[model samples]
Target: MPQSSPRLIGVGGGKGGVGKSIVALTIARVLSDRGDEVVLADLDLGAANLHTYLGIHGRVPTLSDFIAGGMADLSPLLVDTPMPRVHLIAGGVGSLKTANPTFQSKMKLLRHISRLSADWVVLDLGAGVHYNTLDFFNAAHYRVVVTQPEAGAVLNAYGFIKSALLRRISRVFSKDKNLTKALEERVSTTRSRGLLTFCLTDRLSMSPILRGLMMNTGRD
Candidate 1:
C-alpha cells in the first residue's frame, strides 16, 4: 500500500497581533506530546518569527530557500525545535517578492507540503487575505482562524473566513470566465446589501457548474 499523506492544519487570521502563531505552536506541541511527528511550517513569509517562540535563535534554511530555487525540497529546510517530535520549516526573510510569492511557487510549496513524511503538518499562515495566504489556509485539511475578543478582531476574523470561502469558490469556477465574472459581481453587490449568503445561493442555482460544486462540497 502507498504511504499516507500527512494531515495538514492551517492557522490563519485577517488581522495582525491576533496570536495565530501561538495557536499553531500550541497545536503542534500538543500533538507532539501525543507521540505524533509534526512539521510546523511558518508560512508568514516576510514576517516569519515562529522560531522565536520555539527558542531557535540560530539562522536556518527557510521556505524562502525553496521558493527561490536555492533548495530542491522542503525536507532540507526542516529544523528541529525544542518540542520533541515537532520540527519547523522556517519562514523566509528575503526580498519583497519572496514575501509575496507567485502562484506557481505557491503551488510548488503546497505540493511538497502534502508529500512531507510527518504524521501532521501545521501551517502558520500570515495574517490578511493575500492570495498566497488564502491558498495556503485552504490547502489544509483543517482550517483555524484566530481572533481576539475585541470588535475589530471579531470583524476581521469574519472577513478572513468570508474571503477564504470566496477564494475557494472562485477557484472552482476558474475554468469558466463568464461564471467567474458573474460570481465576482454578485459578491460585490450582495456584500453591500448584507445578503451575501442568499445572493450567492441564488447565483449558484443559475449555474450548473456551481450546482455541481455545491453538491460535491456537501459530499465532502
Candidate 2:
C-alpha cells in the first residue's frame, strides 16, 4: 500500500536541558490524539533521551540498527507507545557510532523517514549547531527552536537560528557556484559592517526565493 507523505516537524534546542524532547513528545501526543498517525523519531544522536520522556523503557531497535545493517526496513523498528497511534523510532542507547552517522547514512535515514506511513513525523533533534542537527532542522516543514527564558538559552537559540539560516542558504544554492560565491561575499560584507547588527532581512536580501521561503515559514 502507498503511504501518505508524512509532514515532518523538527523540535530543536541550541543547548541541552531546554525541554526540546518534551515539546516533541507533546506535539506527537496531540497529533496522535487527533487521530493522526504520528511517528516520533529521536534524532538526538549523541545524547538521545526522548524515549525516557515517552516512558519507554527497555531495549528498542533504534536508527543504529538501520545504520549497522541489522534492519533493512525502518517500519519494523517502530515501537508502540502508551499513546495510541503514536509510534517511536528510538535513537538507541549508548554507542557513539550511532551518534555520528555518515552523511550518506543520514541521507538514507531521511529518505526512509519520508516514506513512513504516518500523518506526522516529529524529529527530536540533538542540541548544538552541528551540521547533522541543522540538516534535519532545515528539512522539517515545521521548525520549532525551543529555548528557556534565560539569558544563555536565548542567546544560544539565536545562534542556532543564525546557523540554520546560513545552512539553508548554502543548501539552496549549492549547485550554483556563482550564486554561492556571491552569497559568501555578501555574508563577509555583512559581518565586516556589523556582525551583531545582521538581521533576517539582510540574509534574505540575496535571493528572492529565500526571502519568499522565510516569509512562508511556520505556515501550515
Best by TM-score: 1
Worst 10 residues of 1 by lDDT: 211-220
**Total clashing residue pairs per candidate?**
0, 0
Query: lDDT at 57 for candidate 1?
Result: 88
Query: Which stretches of model 1 miss by more than 4 angstroms?
Result: 185-220
Q: Distance (Å) between predicted and true CA of 26, model 1?
A: 0.5
TM-score list, all predictions: 0.82, 0.81
Candidate 2 per-residue C-alpha lDDT over 91-137 given as tens digits, one digit per residue, 9 for 90 to 100: 95677888888989889899999989898899999889999999998
Which RMSD values do the candidates have, in order?
Answer: 8.3, 6.4
Indicate which candidate wins on lDDT.
1
Put down candidate 1 lDDT per residue, 163-201, tens digits, no spaces. Answer: 887798799999998998888776655553454564354
Stretches of candidate 2 above 4 Å error?
1-3, 184-220
